[model samples]
Target: MADQHTQPAKLYRMMMPDHTCPYGLKSKDLLERQGYEVEDHPLTTRDETDAFKAKHDVETTPQTFIGGERIGGYDDLRVYFGVDKPKDQQSDTSYQPVIAIFAVALLIALGLSWFAFDSILTVQAFQWFVSISMCFLAVQKLQDIESFSTMFLNYDLLAKRWVPYGKVYPFGEAFAGIAMTAGALLWLAAPVAIVIGGIGAVSVIKAVYIDKRELKCACVGGSSNVPLGFVSLTENLMMLGMGLWMLVRLLG
Candidate 1:
């Protein structure tokens, strides 16, 4: 019987002249990190790779083998090592993306404040935080507007009434965010923010609270798993508050 430490893990991956498989590199790195002596096998040509695939009865490169037992691809290796949950068992809900965006936005606002006024806690910084958050959220929606619109139509009253509103929502949020960030064009920004934010808040309240519907939020993007509820409500309320505040400032 071969000693576990003495036996090398086998890694078969694509290392073609023009293209190297990233997952193959990742698999190699993961193996090395786990203290395995890797026996690297590079498939240099398409024909050679195809032959290897045929022999192995596998469709993809970056196949890993530990102790003569095939461990599959990088994702599979992660699961094998308990580094990641199996795909089917992984939770569909995640707030990490939204939390990350807000965290970064807050940091940026504080940094800007210190740069401008030599103070991290200022009214301007608060404004920056909200406006920056709005901008970031808008950018997320704009990434795949069609997908966002489709998701938006699920619960948005205005989107149901007027399909174009779903398409136009991100642009309006972006416009309001930019104008508010600059503290300019309050006349335009305030109304855009107020209307959209007001509608959004009501729609969310009705859908999540009143109707008790379980839906995915399009806040961070169409494909995000962020649940439609408090986080969505907060986003709308922030915009509503920002718009009303700006309107008051403009009137004053």
Candidate 2:
């Protein structure tokens, strides 16, 4: 007898840019074998796609919903249905950005140290710290990969990578912490520098979107794991002012 374990008793609507999808077929086959009502929605326009999501409360393509709870993108649901290995079971995902960020931060730290020795608490020292810290923040960006995946991948390894309702909460919290710290540090050192940092910070804050929280953050090269939240607005604004101040010097 065919293995009865692989099927999901759910409704799945597949959205695609084109009809040819090898990955989706494999997913659909798996869903069908499990007794799912798989509906293929051939998207011809952005408006039609938007209509589908609104009708179904679907935030993700290849959306797999079980009794209305979005199980997630189909592949992750497969794992949820025992189709793939548990995420933690996999090896530490290569934290490529963490490694790279650390290297870059090291350079910034060195520069900061050099400036500190030359003068007692000057703008140059503060600037070095801000530069290195921005690079250091690449750690968060690295961890934000699960967030990155949602924008491109059909299958999600972590939790729901793309949801239409709200993903900004986490990104807001994280960068806020860094920005607050950066801005406060600069505020103490140089008032002008904080203004420049503020602009970039605003750009980052504006970049916050519902898609940003698609997956759990794998911080510090996957060494740290924490859920994201929205209380970060305060700190992020602070960093925004300081970082923007320093940045303006570069442009002008």
Candidate 3:
């Protein structure tokens, strides 16, 4: 009689000449990391893959079987091994990225203040923090202008009427942020920041409060899971405040 305890984990995955399945590689890596010996069975042809799927009554490739019991696909295997939570349990909201960016920007601002004036608690530090945060946020939008613009149009009143405003928004933001960081060109930067920030704040309030609509925010990026709520509102308010402060200083 064969020893069932010593039997290796069996994995069937698609590995055709034209294409290879990524999930298959993930499944293999996961099993290896868990100290399991994988007996990989590659389906080299479409017909062979179809036949395997039909025989196993599964719709996808990269199927795993441990102790002679089927373990569906890569995601299924992850759940089986307690590596990930089930899809239904996962939360959609994520604010960690934005928090991390702001935190880093604050530290940078403080560091710069200490280096320049030998103090970290100066008003200049606060201004630097706001400007640096804006720059970071602008960079995130610039990563995928098209995607950011598309998501922005969902609630931006100006973008809705003027289609090109969505695309131009990121560049404008970047220019304002850079000018603020260098403490130069308040003539142009102040107005740009004021207008954009005012518009953004009003749009967010109308969509989320007045209209009672739920949507994703484009503050961080297009693919961000951050909801259109307090954080988004705060971002715009900060920009508006910074712009006003800069304008006052410039005039006085």
Candidate 3, residue 124: Cα displacement in angstroms equals 4.2
Best by the lDDT measure: 1
TM for candidate 2 is 0.28
lDDT by residue for model 1 (23-110), tens: 9999999988888889999999999999999999999988998889999999999998789999899999999999998999999999
Clashes of each: 0, 19, 0
Write candidate 2's Cα lDDT for 182-206 as tens digits: 5444333333324323432342344
Per-candidate Cα RMSD to the true structure, in Å, reads: 2.3, 15.8, 4.3
Ranking, lDDT, top scorer first: 1, 3, 2
Better of 1 and 2 by lDDT: 1
Q: Which window of ten consecutive residues has the lowest lDDT sum in model 1?
A: 1-10
* Global local distance difference test of model 2: 0.47
Number of the candidate with higher lDDT, 2 or 3: 3
Locate the minimum summed-lDDT window of 10 residues in model 2: 151-160
Ranked candidates (TM-score, high to low): 1, 3, 2
Quote each prediction's TM-score. 0.93, 0.28, 0.77
TM-score of 1: 0.93
> Which predicted model would earn the best TM-score?
1
**Model 2: residues with Cα > 4 Å off, grouped in runs:** 1-23, 35-44, 54-59, 93-252
